[model samples]
Structures are given as structure tokens and as C-alpha cells.
Target: MDITKGYSIAYKGLKNGTHDFAFKVGGALFEAYGSAEIMGGDCDVEVKLDKSETQLVADVTIRGDVVVACDRCLEECRVPVDFEGRLLVKFSDEVREYDGEILWLLPGEDEVDLAQYIYESIVLSLPYQRVHPEGGCDPEMLRRFRIVSDKEFAEIEDRAGAEPDNTAWGKLAELKERMEAGPQDDEK
Candidate 1:
């Protein structure tokens, strides 16, 4: 069996009704796609397809977890995934991609490939900032980060109050002031 072929739904053979299918994606699937965003995790995808004479509507629910680097501690972490999405498949004379949610199929196309959509849905469901739950990360890492960050913050605060005239920003400010004043002697 083709490893990636499992992702294809042969809608042509099915009668007009609702069909349910489940797929376990990750590991080999991720490797097959060579996706770096989600290297390893267990993702369960449930797809409910409602087929009619001319079109098919699929309701996809993705649930599971994916591995990512923690933003706070920089350690590996598992982020839960739970999201619902819709895909509309319509047959047309010419194949055209409408958007992420809509797919256009050619008249003789026999199946719709869903691997890309499933991958995207799972990846997009991840948090923008991946971090372990509060107090869940490595305590030592957190402590070290806190120490370094606090010291850096203190340095920034110390420098915040003192503006050096030799800096480019200071020179720009002086130039701006001079430009705004524009030969002030004549105006006075």
C-alpha cells in the first residue's frame, strides 16, 4: 500500500450519503511530508463526508498533540491540538483552487487528496508562542533565564536614563530640531 495513499478519499465509489473515516497521522506521515514544523506527535483526524450529486462537504476534527520547542525554557514540549474545519469539494470542468477551505476537482478526478489539508490544520492549530504550562518547564532553566533576563533588564534600565550625545539617534534628534528651527535668527 502506498503510505500516502491513505489520505485520499475515493468519493467516486461512494453513494450519496455521509461517510466517516479516521486517520492516525504523525511519525511516518510527518516524515513522508518532510515537515519540520511538527516533527513528532500523535494526531487523530476524524473526517465526516457528506456527498451529494455535484459536491462533497467534509467536516474535519483534529485532536491530539504535537512536539515543539518551549518558548520559555527552550526544551521539548507537547502542545495539544483541537480544531474543527470544513472542506468543500466541487467538480468542475477545470481544476481550480478556491481557498484553503474549497477545492475544485476536474470532471474525471476520482479522489481528493487530504494530506496537505490535515497537516495544515494540525500545524495552524498550534499556539503562536509554544510554551509549557506555568511551572511545568524545567526549574533550573527557568531560574537561569530569570537571572540572565533580570540582569539584562537592569542594564537596560541603567542605560535608559542616560542619553549619550555621540549616538546616531541623538545626532538625528539634533538635526531634526535644527531643521524645525530653520534659521531661527531671522524668525526672531
Candidate 2:
């Protein structure tokens, strides 16, 4: 991933303190990481990196809106997104994987590309349903859905009602009634 020059910060030269970085994201940014559900919109990312002697602590906050396809209507709609997370970067001699979140980088690594991570965070923050509010949905699409659902439900109910209720128990009841009457005149 190509890290935007403005988004990268060299922490080695900075004094031990908290530094703030901001980024304005759009469709172009999403394109850098393959095809994304977010087509267009503006999003703001605020990253606060707390530099310490041996470790770097970063608090990332992302907020704004993104255009995504609605699950129900399949129409593009803008959805607000907000996410907050923290990451810890530890300096180490050998490249080692510690769990999943913690990243180990060589002591000499100059800068880190946060673009991919930020992109993933935004995507992960999306809701599973991805639908517009009830009243906000497209009226035409909603009407069509209601019509189809109602028709399907009516068919199911009709089929259920048409089924005969003459179970084995009902047959046994008829048999018992015939026995109580001793035998039919025809049988006699």
C-alpha cells in the first residue's frame, strides 16, 4: 500500500510526547486497497501517537460517512461510520508475531504505513445488515418487497389450510365409533 506522505510520521526524531495526525479519506483511498464497498464520501481520521522510550502507542479515531450498497434495496446510500481503536508497536530485534494486534518491527524501521490498517478499520466498522432506516428506504423497493412477501406468506397459509386434518388419530376415532356400533348392516 502506498502511504500518503502527509500521513506518515517519523517518530524517531520527535521528542517523547503526544502527536496528533489527521487524514481526509475518500474514494481514492479505498481504491488503493482493492475494491471496497465504500464508493464515495468523505471520512476523517484522527490518530494520536503517544511516543515512549521503548514503545509507541497509537489511538486511532475515524468518523464521517461512506457510500455503500444497501443490503435490502441494493441501492447506494451514504452511511455514517465511527470507529475508535488502539495499537501498540513494539521494537524488537527479530521479526516476531505476537498474537494479532501487536506488531513487532525492527528497531531501524523508519516509518509505518497506516493506510491499510485504517482502511480495514473503517470497513470492519460497517454494520452487517447495511440497510437504510425504515422510512429512509426507497419507497418503490419497499413496496415491491412487501408485495412479494405478502404473496409468499399467503401461498404458505393457503397450502397449510388445504392439507387434510385426517391424521392416524382421527382414523382411530372413526374405527372406535364403528366398533361401538357393533357392525354395519352390510357386514351383518
Candidate 3:
């Protein structure tokens, strides 16, 4: 069965009252959406839908962990997902777009498909900079992708300026010197 089908609610026959719903989100959902950033995850989605004659108010809460590439190490890192928000489902005669806060649907629709909303919420809940905690990343990866420090850049700039010739070989020689001198023994 399609993973997203579990997230749809058949609410046309329901009475005017609040209803609770729960759905499990897994790597399949991400794969279905062809998400490149989210490698995999296990999340729980809880929706409290208050239905009435004209609208449905949904209180959505999502909690789980997603696996993505660490910003620092490029290795798989698990990031926590926690999102709580409200979704107002409003019925209209004309077709309308779903804004972040509200979902607009035609009156004839029998089911509300929440797969897109849940997927986006989980993705959005992730931190802008997803990375393993300090000292948690693989040391080898860290060393491989280490960024140059300000002191190192300044030293290189100073060396380049000190050389009378502003040629490409001058810069290459300086870099070679730094590399051969080793990481800690680069002074002087």
C-alpha cells in the first residue's frame, strides 16, 4: 500500500465534533516524496481534528528523529524533529492553494490528504545546520574537511605579500612549505 494513504482522513461521513488521529512516518514516506536531504527517519504524527459544518481545525504534533548528512562531517547524523502547529481546513467553492497555516479545499472533497503537510512539517522542523554534536562526528571526516583558520589564512597572506614576486608559483611554494611543515609545526 502507498505510505501516504495512511495519512489521509475520510471525514465526509463524520459528525461535527473533534476526532483524534495518529500516523506513523518512516523512511518510505521520504522515499515516496523523493527527498534527497532526508535519508531516513521514524516519526509519529498526532492530529486532533475539530470538524464542523464548514471547516476543520487540526492540531498537529510531530515527534521523531531524521537521518541526514552532517554539515561538519558529511556522515549520517540523526536530528530530532519536534513540531506543533495548527492547520485550518477551510472549504471554498473555488479551488485554492494550501498556505502554510491553512488548507483550502472544495466542498465536494470527501478526504483530506495530510501527507504533504506532515512531510513538510518534519522537514521544516529540522535545524538549519544539521550536524552531529561536538566530538560526536567522525574524527577522520573532520580532519579531511577541516576549514582553514583565520590565523592560517593570515599567515599565508603575509607570506604571499613578503615575497617580492606576485606570481602563481610564489603562492604554490608557500602552500607547499606549510604542508610539509606539518599541522602543528607550521610556525616560522
- Cα displacement (angstroms), candidate 3, residue 182, comes to 24
2 or 3, greater by lDDT? 3
Give one digit per residue, the lDDT tens place, for model 3 in 1-188: 98888899999988999999999999999999999999999999999999999899999999999999999889999999999989999999988888798899999899999999999999888999998999899875664355666677566567667648546445555676788787884476
| Residue 175, model 3: Cα distance from true site in angstroms | 20
- List of clashing residue pairs for candidate 1: none
Residue 132 Cα positional deviation in candidate 2, in Å, after optimal superposition: 1.2
Best by TM-score: 3
> Which digits, one per residue and each the tens of the lDDT, describe model 2 over residues 106-165?
999878667766788888898887888886777655544454454664554455465563
- Cα deviation at 116, candidate 1, in Å, is 0.5
Go through the candidates in order and give each one's C-alpha lDDT: 0.82, 0.76, 0.88
Best by lDDT: 3
Better of 1 and 3 by TM-score: 3
State the weakest 10-residue window (summed lDDT) of model 1. Answer: 164-173
> What is candidate 1's CA lDDT for residue 39?
65
**What is the lDDT, from 0 to 100, of the residue 143 in candidate 3?**
48
Ranking by TM-score: 3, 1, 2
